[model samples]
Target chain A: GQQVMQIPQYQHVQEGEDFTTYCNSSTTLSNIQWYKQRPGGHPVFLIQLVKSGEVKKQKRLTFQFGEAKKNSSLHITATQTTDVGTYFCAISFGNEKLTFGTGTRLTIIP
Target chain B: DAGITQSPRHKVTETGTPVTLRCHQTENHRYMYWYRQDPGHGLRLIHYSYGVKDTDKGEVSDGYSVSRSKTEDFLLTLESATSSQTSVYFCAIRVTGTETQYFGPGTRLLVL
Candidate 1:
């Protein structure tokens, strides 16, 4: 069995501010993926980090995979109202099965 | 939005009843999963199918079972539902050998 934990269970940020959430695993992962679920919406695929110590960016959002492949982070710069949602980090231990973290719910203030 | 659809967008059933939720995908993906979302729990996987007639349990599989008779359809059945089983259920699909999973609009179920 695999377990994934996320930090800052909930984050509230004012518009134009920055936010970051961390994900950690008790076991090593083969790959990790990120997803965003909007308010009252389904979870949507964001990105996946496969290689250790990998860093990828999507516009103002930056994702990082730890060197040990046991942790990851998602950082959003200058957040906007559209950024309000729950961000989840999912990891696969050795195959297709994925275990999702508790997720970090974000709320943006006007 | 990835050609994935969930039926009975909302359901209100009584306890001790058997409820089945259907997930249909036009993409014909090899991997299909059922998950339930609750407060502070995020999304907990119920079951997943790798192919036709192939399914396995997930972290929160109790009281839930799934069947995949075709590559495009996955069904999640709750036998003898309870109040604790009331939550928003989502169906997701991913291509073989890929890590990305696309989810369908959730089906909100309430057991009275």
Candidate 2:
């Protein structure tokens, strides 16, 4: 079994400020995927990172996978109200079965 | 939003009752999964189906069972519902070769 934990259970930032959430796994992971769940909405796929120390960017968002493959991070630059949601990091167990992180709920105040 | 639909968007049941939640997909995906979301536990997988008649238990499979009789449908059943089972349940689908999962609107279940 694999376990993924996320930091800063809840984050509140100004609309123009930057924010970051981290995900750590108890065991080594082959790859990590990120998802975003808006309030009262379903989780939506954002991106996936493979290989050690991989980094990918989606517009204003940046995602990184640690060299050890046991940790990952999602950083948002200049957050906006549309960015308020729960961000989750999911890891697969040698296959397509994904284990999701605890999630970091982000709130942006204008 | 990926042609996924979960029935009875919300449900309220008493303890020791049998409840079944249905997940229907129009995408005809090979992989379908059932997940429960709580306040602090994030999303935990309960069961998943790889094919019409093939299903596997997930990490949180206890007290939950799933059946997939057709390619477009997956059902999650609770033999006897308990209060601890109250949570938001989501259904996700993934294509044969993709790692990304698209989710249904979700079903919120409350067991009293």
In DockQ terms, which candidate is top?
A: 2
Which run of 10 residues does model 1 chain B get worst, by summed lDDT?
B93-102
User: All candidates' TM-scores?
Assistant: 0.97, 0.96
Q: Candidate 2: which pairs clash? A: none
Clashes of 2: 0
Q: How closely does chain A match the true chain A in each prediction, as TM-score?
A: 0.97, 0.96
User: What TM value does chain A in model 1 reach?
Assistant: 0.97
lDDT for A60 in candidate 1 is 99
Candidate 1: chain B TM-score equals 0.97
Task: Write one digit per residue (lDDT tens) for candidate 2, span B1-112.
Answer: 7799999899999999999999999988999999999999999999999999899989899999999999999999999999999999999999668788999999999999
Candidate 1, residues B2-50: lDDT per residue as tens digits?
7999998999999999999999999878999999999999888999998
Backbone clash numbers for all candidates listed: 0, 0
DockQ of candidate 1 against the true complex: 0.86
Off by over 4 Å in 1: none
DockQ of 2: 0.87
lDDT of 1 at B3: 94
